[model samples]
Target: MRALHIILFLFSFLFSGFFINGQEQLTKHATDSIEELVQKSRKLLADFNIKESLDHTTKVIKYAHEINSNVDISRGHYFMACNYEVIQDFSNSEFHYNEALKYAELAKDSLWIIRSLNGLGNVYSEGYKNLEKGTFYYNKSLEIVEKSNIKTEKLGPILNLGWTYIDEEKYDLAYPYLLEAQKLAQELEEIGRIVAINDIKYLLGRYYAGKNEIEKANQLFNEVIKAVESLEIISVLTDTYKAKSEAFQKVGNTDSAFYSIKKYLFYRDKLLDEEKIKQVEIAKANFSLDDFQRQLDATKKEKEYLAKIARSNMVINIISISLVLLLAGIFFFYRGYQSKKKLSAVLKEKNEELQEAKTEAEKLTNIKSQFISTVSHELRTPLYGVVGITTLLLEEQDIQEKHKKLLNSLKFSGDYLLDLINKVLKISKIESNTEKLTKTPTNLIELSRNLLHSFEYQAKSKSNELILDIQKELPGVLSVDSLKLSEVLINLIGNSTKFTENGKIWLRIKILSLEKDEITIRYEVEDNGVGIPEDKKEFVFEKFSQVGREFNKSEGTGLGLSIVKNLLEMMDSEIHLDSKEGRGTKFHFDLTLEIIDEKGENELNPENSGINQKFRRILVAEDNKINQIVTKNLLDLIGYECTIVENGFNALQMVQKEDFDLILMDLNMPYLNGVEATKRIREFDQTTPIIALTASELSEVKEECMSIGMNDIINKPLDKNDLRNIISKNLLG
Candidate 1:
């Protein structure tokens, strides 16, 4: 009996230990499964598949709860909360965050708790705009991180707090947090530190811009733009460029402003296109996933049915049936594979076609741009002479009244035609995405006053009071696209003056922000005349649009506001309209400029600014008899002793033989082109200035002239002022 009892005890102990080991293995497997699910959820979140992330987290939570693992449950809830926050489901985000925190507290997991707090903070601040509530949670998380040795998660709350303050316009309060975050970000090894630094600079730029330290702001903005552009951070780069444009415009650098604005638009549009493509891909992937799920379900059900049949059937029959099912499965899978391959090929072909179409469209656009540019240049040359000669003739003392009146009409017609041509070219350039900004030093106050003054007579005709309100202590000289700025201002002021009758028209300019070398300016053209109707306001900016067709018969091409809108767009600005019927309209916009320490030479006085008094000979090259006469007459008027040449060959021959001060070589000539002539002349007479007279506004022509050793270039149909200025700049220098 003692031997039996000992044996029984041994057996029981062996059985119990085996059972316990098996249970332990099963529990480990379950835990591993939960972890795998959590990892998958994390990957889904990383890919921004929030719905899938939520579903995976939900499964993870269910599995964790079944296993009674508090830590894993907390992780599952945390992931769920993050997904909810991403989807902007604030209520669910808050609930899951609280649940995560509860489980984390139960598990005594500090990291999970900190994450939950941070998530809650994000939900309140970014989603609900509850800054105080968000700050409280962030502070709690920060406190926890400080107590712990973990530095990886430290910057999150700090950055969040800083951005929150920035959005609230509390720059003073934002800086401390941003600075701290910037310092902490450098110590982080896992994330890219250089990108982090640039991001910090981006925020700092905005802060300084808000503080009216435009120069400092621009420096920071530029740094960010340089780094982020190379990094291809499209969203951030777009915002940075836009901010930089605004900063430049403030200081009156409309050229830089337009350049920056174009960059911003390019990146912005690229981002949008990328997002659209991603959405399409996602839709396709989702459809494929659904199809795969259905196929998997069908295969599983087929397998289950086969297994049941195999269990009950004879051996030979079971084998035969199994073989048939295997063959069927193979056939179906092969068919499916072939279908997928065909679909892929079709998609590829379609993509290729799309690429070809895009290429063709871009080619067409370039052609259109070039055609318009060439035509505009050609037209401007003759128009310049017509307007200039007509004006000069009108000023003659011995002319009859009727002749003078007719001359005035001819001048008016020429001016109107020139305006029409310019407007068309501007519109074409914009449409073809070929407009380029040229920067030069400009006086903002003087430019504004000149624009306002130009419209004074027109205002008086309507018995309107023109008021100029400019901010005091504003910077005078700024680098800007003077032409575009003038165009925008003229359009806005002209529209206001024309519309307002027997009322007040105010041209107001104020400083939006100022940095050391950069500034943002706000301009307002307000009128209390025949106000735009609420319904008609939207149409005012449309091309060929007129405001209130029934009330007014204004003799305009209706391109003023339309041109203003386009010009402002080029300058990275937008027009804001506020108007009421019978009351008035206020058109507001903003521009950025870069302040210049010294004025540019282009700021010439029209009356006395000319070449130094010297009896110098000039050679005029031309292919047309009419242009030769016109050129000679204009040169005579300016007291320049000029010798006329019929073409580029004669001009080149004359320059090589005679000691001429300057040569105006025509580009399109009979034998040798101006470019070749200039090249040939440079071989022998390199000292004399060879100015190419071309009827092409395209910069390529200018580049061609420069490459062939030409000293300067003058466009035809040129203004007398432009000609004189060019002459003084090149010859006098």
Candidate 2:
């Protein structure tokens, strides 16, 4: 009896041990599966597959709940928050992130706790634009990181704090946090540290740009853009472009600003499209989950009915089958409804995107127009001094023959530069749809003669013969946009001059048709030079398109032919190109212009007769010393005495004290600008001819100059002949 009792005890103990081992194995497998799901969720989220990531996290959370594992639950909720945030469902994201934080604290997982805190910060700061709330969460994360001495993990919270301050435009407070993050990233050897460094650099660039330190800001922005592009970090690239655009706009660099904003929009649109795709996928996933739940509930009901009908009749079983089929039909109908709803939402979002893009495009156009005007003024200001000095040197009678030749060359180059600037501005105006044709009675014969005469120095330098061939039947006077016509002819002739050496170039006008009211005339510019290749012919008229740069020694901005094409088009004409490689090129265009009889035309040749040279004193208001010297020398050459003032205030003072025949006021001046001074001067003394001198586009300032009681306006680099003519006309009138 004693031996049998001992054997029973041993059997019972071995059976209990086996049961305990089996239970332990099952628990380990379940935990391993949850861990695997959490890892997959993280990867999918990082790849921007928000729906797939959420699905994986959902599975993880379900398994974690079954096992009652706090760590796994925390991880699942953290990833769920991230996916929600990506979809911009901030309320859900905030709830999930809080849940994650609570579970992480329960699990005593510091890494998850920090991540959850940062996630909350991003939700508040970026999505909601609530900087104060965002900063609080970021600081909480930072506090924990500092206490734990986790250097690798601290970079994120620090960077987040800096970003919050920058968003608030509080760069002074942002700098320290950004600097600390940069230093920490530099010390770390983590794989993600490079990305962290780039983030810090981008924030620092924003800080400097806000301070209006453009050069420094641009340098940092360039660096960040290059690195992020290589890393394929699109989000950072978009933000960087937006910041860069704002920086350029602040400094009135309209071109750069426009370019940056375009890039910003492109990337932003790309992101939007990707996000839309994700949203659709998420919607499908939601429908799938709902379908699964309904099917699961139906299965439970069917099983309960089967058990209940086992003891009942066949009629009850048939009724249960009918109910199951009815539920399945309802599920299909619900799915169809969901799909249509999702499609409608997507279409509405796309329409909104298009409207936004259109508005941005219009804004960019306005920016481009402003940029062109600003650049024209800035460029012409310095060019005025260059051209004026060169002209003055050329007029000196005692200049050596060699120096005279050099001066002529210098003058030619200066003139070429001015033409190039004008061409660029013209292209901008044409593209902006601002250019218009203004017709007046013009002498075609004199206009053609002057156009040829202007290119004489250029033709001589290239050993090219310039020929003017006008049909005898062509009318001498016609109503046309002389400025536009002149520009077109100048560009064509200039293009021929640039390519042809030791060749004959002709500017020809043939009367295609003659009528009582108008005449159709075909104009041609033919040159024997390095003709464009057949493949390049089509591209020759493109802006900034150049050909034969390797062989041709001539240098140009490649805008001549394009300007010709645009101007001709504006005049309701088309430019045709004919060329053979290594032979010659001919460009022709036709225009129908109104005939103006010579009997009705009146001409005034202003006489410098009325002014007494000694008594006619001109007061010149100029801030730049070089410009002042140039203006004074030109006036002296014109045989007039002038008093110079450094600024508009001084000019006002001089005008009040002394008597002057005219005041040459430079529009841009120190202390007081020409416009304000003219306003003040007109308040007291209104009779003196205040000829506004400017290096800006004449049309931009002309009306204001005229409205401010100024009698006339003169564009600068002070053309000797124009200066003499304008001064004589104003003084005589």
Candidate 3:
């Protein structure tokens, strides 16, 4: 039932030999001696001989410090922390865990550091009931495990996190973690990790019981009890019975609860017999007394050593005074010259190494960028066909109602996948410093109104009221990155709508300061919804972090707020949040922008103005068959006749053979790419419009498309409206 307690025993047995193996560089005899002490200490601890274990661990620490072995020192302190935790001395457990962490970091041992962090987490979570601090340490441990790809070491932190969430009665939050732990436990079971298997089974039983799934919970509990009984894991047996009793009580099964409680009491008493209890008490008293005596003895020895050093230094200094006078400036100059020459040579060598490293790093970065671009194109190509087909199907008027519902769901999923892909690529670009701000003339009030309009369907679905408030004194237009600003607002507003139901959400814009050339405007998105907890505020902006995942599990991929933070920072602004639980949340930020034109045009334009229905011939150049079908169908929907070509080379031939109003050229095509084909076409026909259709990132190809005489570019997994608008605008020009 308690993962921390169960994992503590496993940690001892698994890591007992870690320090011994790490000290292989020492003398064989010394290593053998230390190894024996470590093994004996662990055995005594396992056997419940607390005093004997402490004595052996103390000796190990002394020997380790004398030999200056940080690995051994950390091991000793970690074991001491475990023993204290077993005895419920959380203060001492916390102190020793910290000390162990310090030495583990000094030794550069990641495994020991993770162990120390988990130990501290257990002290806070299990002993003190401080879930916040406990969750922090557990997350830290998991972060290290993930970064290091230590598959074998990830189960502890994951189990502990699930256990903590269950303690908070947030069963929804605990479910995913417990399921992941169950998967990991099964993997470990393949390698014969019996303890982990039983621990996960027990924790999962508790989770099911908490969720009122009594039958499933009882089945899991029965299996765990059978396994732990066979293994003679008395502590686990006691904890399981206690949890089963509480679960039965929750369901008002008084007779079963009573039976379970009796079993729990029996096991608890068996695990801690009266004689064992007396011995543990006596051990605690003796440990305190011995600690005091050891401190006194150490103080005496330190004073005596310092006195000896003082006398030795006094005699050495008197001799050094005479020696210095005899040696004079020649020795000093020679030593200084040699030292500078060695230092300069070392610096030069280091600089050469740094240059080589920089070159290798740049090479790797380029490789990563190329890989991402290739993957994006490959994924988007297929996704475009799916999304396009789904859209076309949904537009059919004679479809069955049930099938229409299914199609809508399919469309939602396709759109979600496309959004996830775009966000991921956006993150990659930002992290690589390839994302740049393009400051364009923008209407502030109109942009805010349009962003709110975009979320109307979502808001209505949630039964939430959407409000936009803009100060009259604000300028009509400002020089800003409207694309990035829209992205940030869309994410924020979308989150508010997703988390709030039958509540009011507001997008407020205020002029903080107005100047002749620049104005500082504050933008706020506030919602009366389920707000974030205080402990989770700092992590809201972390990548892939979902604060209210338990409330809305399927809504987001947890990248929105992280993208918002990065984009705002790029624009030289910061986002701030204020919220309380069960009330509301508000996110605000301020940006100072240059006034482009005070009386800028703020006209609202319809997305799809009907284009002329004149007989116009269009050329479609694409390599994929599915894309060709989807594209041709789309153009057909818009009442345009299209000629299809298998590649850019074929498109060039077709264009030369006949006159066409526009050409939709796929960027990556066989025989000839869009860029090359566009160049060839420009040499002959300069009047016809050529539009680049790419599955690659638009930023990567936009400039090249323009340079190659392409009029515009559209990303794949494209929206139908975007396709229509681009085609219409290009044809008009």
Candidate 4:
């Protein structure tokens, strides 16, 4: 049974393509050509063209090396070993078999491992007639089969074991295994089962004859002869005829035994001729190997001759060039020194001017950042009042339907305005190089699906469909900055929604490849929108540049794709754009994420609870009165009462005299700013959560707040949910 398994396994290696783990990295045509060459080699071997077959097989091995395919190379080695075995070259056969085993294990191919084991067993049992070593190899092969529970071709080794015992004259030990092989072979499909059944029957007949059961042994031999006569398996028929002759002679039938002996001798002579032809084939194959080795030696000798000639020419050239180079070196050294003296003064003047320009640029950058931060804070303070008041008003049921609609519209506008402000500040922080990416274990498929579900409403409003295509084999979790990933997806999908109407948008995430601890995935957002013009394709990634299209005539700050580009670049990736006029647009990028353990989920994901969790007392520090009202009311809505102070200085004094569980210290306050006040407060009170509450989007200020012992920072105009979450997390911690 194990022999049958090994034959089929070897058959596959000869006839089919070998698969490398990363076969996708190879071009399809290259893989196909290699497979074709291997199959061709199998045909040549079957036709007894051993020399040509070895040629083709060795070509495959070389090609496999060119492509760096360990599995294919293993298949090549295994086939070459089979070729060597056919030539009666047991030494070379063993060497190639061991080589095959080495690479098969490297390729993690269990079936190939079994094939190598069985082949080695045959070399010991049939070639060297070493029963002990043969039994060891056969047992190891069976262990692999049993462990893997592979039933398709397990009869090969059982049959081999039966034969090994029979050859050693242990008929009793061989009978049980041969019978088992017979039963297993009957379960197989037609032609192969027939061949295997006849082979096993002959072995069982030999065993019966050894036990001196002449009648049973003769009956079994007759049945095997009848089955294999038309099948033309010369070896089986010859063995069966000889065994029947022995049984007849033991039963004292001289004439019948002589007839059977004559038949056996006829087939034996034919088999001998076949063996001679096979030896001739082996000689031709050896000639081919010798020819190839000679060619390699000739090429090596040619290379050595060429090297000798080149070395001889090199001495003459060096002697000719030394004097010229020495004169040239002195002239260049003097000329270079004279030039350096004049260039040094000019370089010094240029360096001073360049330093001044760099300083001026830095100063202007600071000024622009400060102006944006200040304007953002001022706008957020007023917007906070508008949104908070509108939210509180919407909670009242007595309002008329028209007034309610107006209030809803106003609130939507305020929210949109706040989003625009946040985008501007995000761009500022990114340009200033102050934003940091924090990685966590996240299920990207779940994250992508959840993000798509969130946009269902917006997609429906435009009569568009959001489609999600995620690879089923994608790993459950990866270490990444999920917040940034979500933001990038949102921007891309949001852009699709804005420009697309009555169409479909697809968000596709698929695993590209997985190596050891890192998996690369490709994310694509595609939409059948009025695509951007070719001229404006590059322009759209620039900040605040919208493509000139009718569908894109709607209101947008145009910072969405720019922010996506920057964020991806920060993560060491780039966003690719593919668009065609009036067709569609596709934004895709590849990201490689580190694999993380499922148990580390909680370690990577912090709990963010939006439920109201109020403390005993809260402090509100702001210079703006509307901001104070908005902050106090927002806190009160969440079941906390806060004392308002006019500025950081007043808040600092009040904090020393009064007790508060949390402080929402505004960063840009009058008198003493939030950084100073927080520093002073931390000097005495380090236990309370001092959260920096500001509309400024500068990461520098956030870092400064943390440096002064602030626990967290929340950007405004803040959502009620964000405020609740931040407060609960900091206060409870």
lDDT of 4 by residue, 143-181 (tens): 887886655436777888897887788998898899889
Off by over 4 Å in 1: 1-335, 381-385, 453-467, 502-505, 548-554, 599-603, 609-614, 690-692, 698-700, 706-714
TM-score of each: 0.55, 0.52, 0.55, 0.49
lDDT (tens digit, per residue) of candidate 1 on 1-733: 1111112222232233422332343344357778678768866665555546666787788778766777778878887776555444567778889999999888776766777898888778876779999899999999988887556567767877887787788999999999997898667442346555766788899789878898899899888878767756666787788778767766767567656765765675575457432322232211234444655675465345435444544345435544554554454445445544554464466557657766887899889877877788778777867876786686578999999979978987987887777777777777777677778788888788877887776777789898999988788788888878888878778787777788998989889999998999898989887788777878889888887566667756888788888878878899999988888889999888898886453565645754553487888888777677777777777778889987778877787678988888888889887888888888877688878887665444766778888888876665666677677767755
The digit string of per-residue lDDT tens for model 3 on 432-492 reads 7888998988988888997899899888888999999998888777999998999999999
The alpha-carbon RMSD values of the candidates against the true structure, listed in the order shown, are 25.4, 28.4, 24.0, 21.5
Off by over 4 Å in 2: 1-340, 368-372, 405-409, 596-600, 604-615, 653-659, 680-689, 709-711, 729-733
Structure candidate 2, residue pairs in collision:
none
RMSD of 3: 24.0
Off by over 4 Å in 3: 1-328, 345-359, 549-554, 598-610
lDDT of 2 by residue, 1-733 (tens): 1111111211222233412332243344357778678657766665556556767887787677666777678777877777666555567779899999998898776766887898899889876779989989998998887886655567677877887888789999999999888787776444355566777788899999999999999999999999879766666788889789779878978668757865875675565457534343344422444545665675565445434434544455445544654664465446545754664475366557657766887789879988977888888888888888999888888999999988888887888788778778878888778787778899888789889998998899889999999988887789999988998898888889888999999999999889998999999999999888999898889888888776766468888888888888889999999999889899999999999888966443444364566667999999999999999999898788999999999998998898998999999998999999999999999788889998776756777899989998888778877788788878776
What do the candidate models score in CA lDDT, each in turn?
Answer: 0.72, 0.77, 0.77, 0.74
Candidate 2: what lDDT? 0.77
Return the candidate ranking by TM-score, descending: 1, 3, 2, 4
Candidate 3 TM-score versus the reference: 0.55
